[model samples]
Target chain A: MCGIVGYLDKVGTEGGNVGSVLLGMLTALACRGPDSTGVAVFGQHRPDELIAQIKLGENGNGTEYARKIEETGKEFGGREFSQTSAYLRFVFTETNDLHAFITRVEATGDPVEVVSVGRRLEIVKQVGSPSRLEKTFGISAFQGKHGIGHTRLSTESVVDLSHSQPFWGHGYPDLAIVHNGHITNYHQLRRRYEQRGTRFYTENDSEVVAVFLVDKLQQGRGLHTAIESIVRELDGSFSCLVATDSALAFVKDAFSFKPLVFAETDDFVAVATEEVAIRNAIPGDFTVREAQAKEVRVWSR
Target chain B: MVEIDAAGRTTREVNRAIRQRIAESCKEVVLRNPGARHNLAVAILEDAHIRIAGSAGYYCGGLIDGPSIEVEGSAGWGLAESMLSGTVRVHGSAGSGAAAAVRGGTVVIHGDAAARLGVSMKGGIVIVAGNCGYMAGFMAQKGTLIVCGNAGEAFADSMYATVCYVGGEIANLGTDAVIAPIDAGEAQQLEKILSTHLPATLRSTKPAAADFKKVVAGRKLWNFDKREWRTWQEAL
Candidate 1:
């Protein structure tokens, strides 16, 4: 079973120290999953700037990929270029088309994949523990309004960055999700979405949740309405946390097969698969309650 | 009386310290800063009083006997599971599968309990001061489960000789779980049990034992018959 953790600052106290809080919570849940760690942090919103993160292929030459990315950035008017070992980050003016920019970046050859593109959302995932995530990306240094994370235990998917969770809604800006249980109807739903020309980035079952939810948002449904529909439509044992630019929400399946607990105070709200994570990472007293079957709650900034 | 601090200590270390204290004939052991840790106290066959100051994670007091354990905070899943004897009480709520497969014991929860409470209990008494989640007492063999508040869907499904009593509304009964009328004598026994375990303030807030609805298995699944198609259909 994988572990899911989410933290949202209600009072907006200087980025909420979200990075450090999420790191500690995920570390406490390391025993649940040892395959990989993934986090999606929603930072300060820029109305006219879009941030894009890309994962380079494992076998490609790093220098070659970097050179290609730099050349593409020049043509696309991208700025704030940052490169990690296997990932690249770029900020582009919002005047550019999101789909076109993603296409242009992936066209740089070397099997480039866009991890996420949004004004406030930045997703980073790698094959390692939560501590490894800190060493590699200094995740605790990230300051943001809200965030969600995942510790993955690969069930049917391969252990790789692409298969990792906290999946970004590819076309839906500022949308990310982390799931704990398997979607029983993944294949049927994937086929239906594929027929509509929806591009699926991963073979994992949980990827369908991001696509399904983004589809609802595109249909002009409110976040709460969309999550409620998840309880009805999705068939399986799942407890998922979905994050948008301004809100964080969790939805549990009707069967209550998967476990999810949340602790809330006036300052912030924290949720995890187990109370151990919340108690170990968060100080102070707050009553922890288990999310019942078909429960959907949203906390907004 | 002795005190053990779980701060910055491994589970094995904390348990070792507890066993050491017990060996030294400490009458009472207080563990602080439990931090919702898993398997805090397990396989303790000694007679002593153990107290957890804060929350505990999965399997807090499992496979134990002859010790009265108390958790001042909420407990995670599988609390007091498979305990042959002893009493495990939590002042706060409990996660799923509380007291699962216990052979003998009394597990009491003062707050609401998550799903699957007292599942497959061979022998024991589980009392919840508040509501319980879905499918509680599923496949239980022999025991008593008392819910002072509402019971969620499919209560006591496919059980064997396990008796249930709910003081509040039941969302739905499970397959082969039939309601039986409670006699005055049994109601008095329930009242005594509730009074012995729950505090005065808590007992005042919940429904009295006289109003509890008794539930038991119809035992049709124990020996199947082709003519009982409706029961067989739902049981499958």
Candidate 2:
């Protein structure tokens, strides 16, 4: 099992320190997933281009990383800039060989992990506790209108940095997800996506959720529509939080096997694995409520 | 009366100390600055009086036996879950699945409650002074849910032996749970039960049982009759 938290500023002026609140929410869920933690934050949006958050894996050196970035940037019509020691930011034209570009970055053999791909979404995550991650990434310095976070238990995949959660919809802009519970048909879905040449990074069932969603979004479906389809098509006990540059939303499994709570106020909307996280993230008497079985809720600024 | 501050301690530390104190001749325990932590004061089998001054997180006073617990503030999910014998009073609201699957207990809620208030309960007595959300007693086998206020959708779906009484509107009733007539004797019995467990102010202001609607299982569901089973299988 895992934990998820999603947030959106409804009033639009709350340029909240989204990373700080996300870390607090993730900290509340540390007991649920002690193995690793991840977060996806959406800041200022860019219309004509998509940004990718980068992390150099085991074999990435400055010289080789520059060469790989040069190669992928030329192919994708993009450019790269450093955000932090572990995080590099890349901007790409919307209609380039984006799929191939991601594959190139991922398949560098030594692994240049593309943590997220979106117009404003930049996911910073690793194999550590929530508090530890905050120290390493200066996540508290990130300011945004909305974001999503997760603490993963690592049930289906190896306990590695790249396998941590808040999976990015690699092919879709500004789409990321943090999920709790399992996907019963992940192997079948993985095979289907793999047959279609979709490159998968980890064996985590949650990664399949991001891939599945991007597939639907790429097929001209809206966020709400894709989530509704997911409730029907996917069979499992999952409660997931999804984030986009414009919105934050969540969907629960039909049986509601996993715990997910959300709070709504005039200024903001917050969702988490439990109300405790929501309580800590949002201040003052927001109306806290449970996500009903099979409920899909969306909120935006 | 014994008082303990839970401001700077983990749930483990608080619960361990509370349990230890209860074992060492502590009859009344007060926990201040609860910090709304999960699983606070869980699995106590003593007959002590435990009072939490601040809000509590999930499963507060869960599996409680023989204790009379009270919360001055709100509580999170599954409050008093699976308790055998206790009197739990929540002065503020409670989260979903409160008093779920209790074998024996008396839980009184002074304020509104969230969804799935008492799921799959085997036996218990639940009294809510305020409205409750959906599926208040879903799949309950045996218990009694008395709501002085409104009830949300699908109240008591598929309930086997559990009985429900609501003074206000019911959005929907689940399978096998139907509105049944409240005889004079049953109405008086519910009032007696409420009086015994409710606070003095609430007991005095209790709604008349005659004004409430009674709900119970559709007896046929209690037995897996061959005819009913065939009907169910065909539907499936």
Candidate 3:
């Protein structure tokens, strides 16, 4: 089992303390998962610029890897370079071929992975708990309109930076997903997607959700439609939360095998695998309710 | 009445304090600032009243032989599960598996209940004043489950001698679950149960007991018959 959390500022004009709220929620749910923690936050959006986070593997020289990534950025006219631990962030102009650009970045020496590429989304994940994430990245000080966080317990997949979730929707910018339960039909779905030439990145079953959403969006289906289709097509006992640049959505399987609760006030909306997350994170009065079986809720800025 | 503050204490400390107060002959114990912590007031064998001022986490009031536990806010999963005898009443909703496998008890939810309510019960009376989610009373054995609001899909699947009543619309019945007519005595008994557990204001807003539909096992699942192949296929 994993813990998934989503928060959105209903009063969208001001950027609330999205990061700190997410940290509080994730920390409360730390008991659910101890392997890894990650968050995908939506920051100030510039329509013409694209932001990307690249995970430089921990095995190599940090400065050397940063320099190589800077060189690659210069090749693509990327600017605003920043580094946090093993992660490198840069802004580049909108590219016509994102897949080729990501492919180019991943080929830079030893085991470079592109964690996320989006106009407003920036994903930071590592192989540790929420406290470790906070110490490493100071995640609580982050301010934004909305974000999604996850603490993962590796049931079938290996515990590593690459296998951790808040999985970016591979080529789909600004789309991220976190899931709580296993996808029973992962192997069959993987075979079908692979036959249709979809790349499988990690052996993690949850990764398929992001890819599936990307595929649906490519087919011109809206986000809500894609999520509804996921409830129908995906065979599993899962409760999933999906976040994009402008909206957040929650989806549960027919059986509702996983636990998910949400609290809504006039000011903000918060959802987690347990109500304790929201109660401990946010103060004041709010109505907390459980998301029923085969339920989907969406909030947009 | 004794008040135990749970603000800065661990779960073990709070439970210990509760048991300690009961040992000291405190009749009524009120837990303040519960903060949705799990396993509060679990396995208490004393015959006393415990009131949780705020929301509680998983397994609240579980494994208790005697005690009337009240929650002002909601409860998490496995609320009052495996109780030998007692009453667990939640002013707010309940999480999944409320009153699961209870040998004897009364579990009441003033608001909605999530999935798997009263699942695998040996004996008890489970009541939800509001709606309930899917697979509620699934595989339940020898108990009475009641839902005042709408029942979600696959209600009461694969039960053994467990009687169920739904006051609102049932989305769909589960495999081998058949609806039988509710007799006058059963309806009056349901009314008495509701009045005994619910407050007057809350009781007035709910549907009358006479409107409820009774659901029981068809007994086809009790023993496998080759002629009932289709029913057995779905049950499996």
Which candidate's DockQ is highest? Answer: 3
Which wins on lDDT, candidate 2 or candidate 3? Answer: 3
Q: Which stretches of candidate 1 lie over 4 Å from their true place?
A: A59-61, A73-77
lDDT of 2 by residue, B1-236 (tens): 89999877878899998988899999999998775678988899999999987677889989888998888777888999999998889887788889999898899988777778888888889888888877789888888998888888778877788899998899778666789999999989988887777777876675777878999877656667787885356323
Would you estimate the TM-scores of all the predictions?
Answer: 0.96, 0.84, 0.97
Candidate 3 is graded, for docking, as: medium
- Per-model root-mean-square deviation over C-alphas: 1.7, 3.9, 1.4
Which tens-of-lDDT digit does each residue in B86-162 have in candidate 1?
99999989999998999998999998888899999999899999999988999999988999999988999999998
Q: For residue B83, what is the lDDT in candidate 1? A: 95
- Candidate 1, CAPRI quality class derived from DockQ: medium
All models: lDDT? 0.90, 0.81, 0.91
Restricted to chain B, the TM-score per model reads: 0.98, 0.92, 0.98
Candidate 3: give its CA RMSD in angstroms.
1.4
lDDT (10s digit) by residue, model 3, range A1-301? 7899999998865366899999999999998899999999998888788899998885324667778888888777799998888898899988878988888888886568889999899899998899999998898988788999999999999998888989999988899999999899999989999999888879999999998999999999999999999999999889999999989899999988999998877788899999899888987756577889999998887
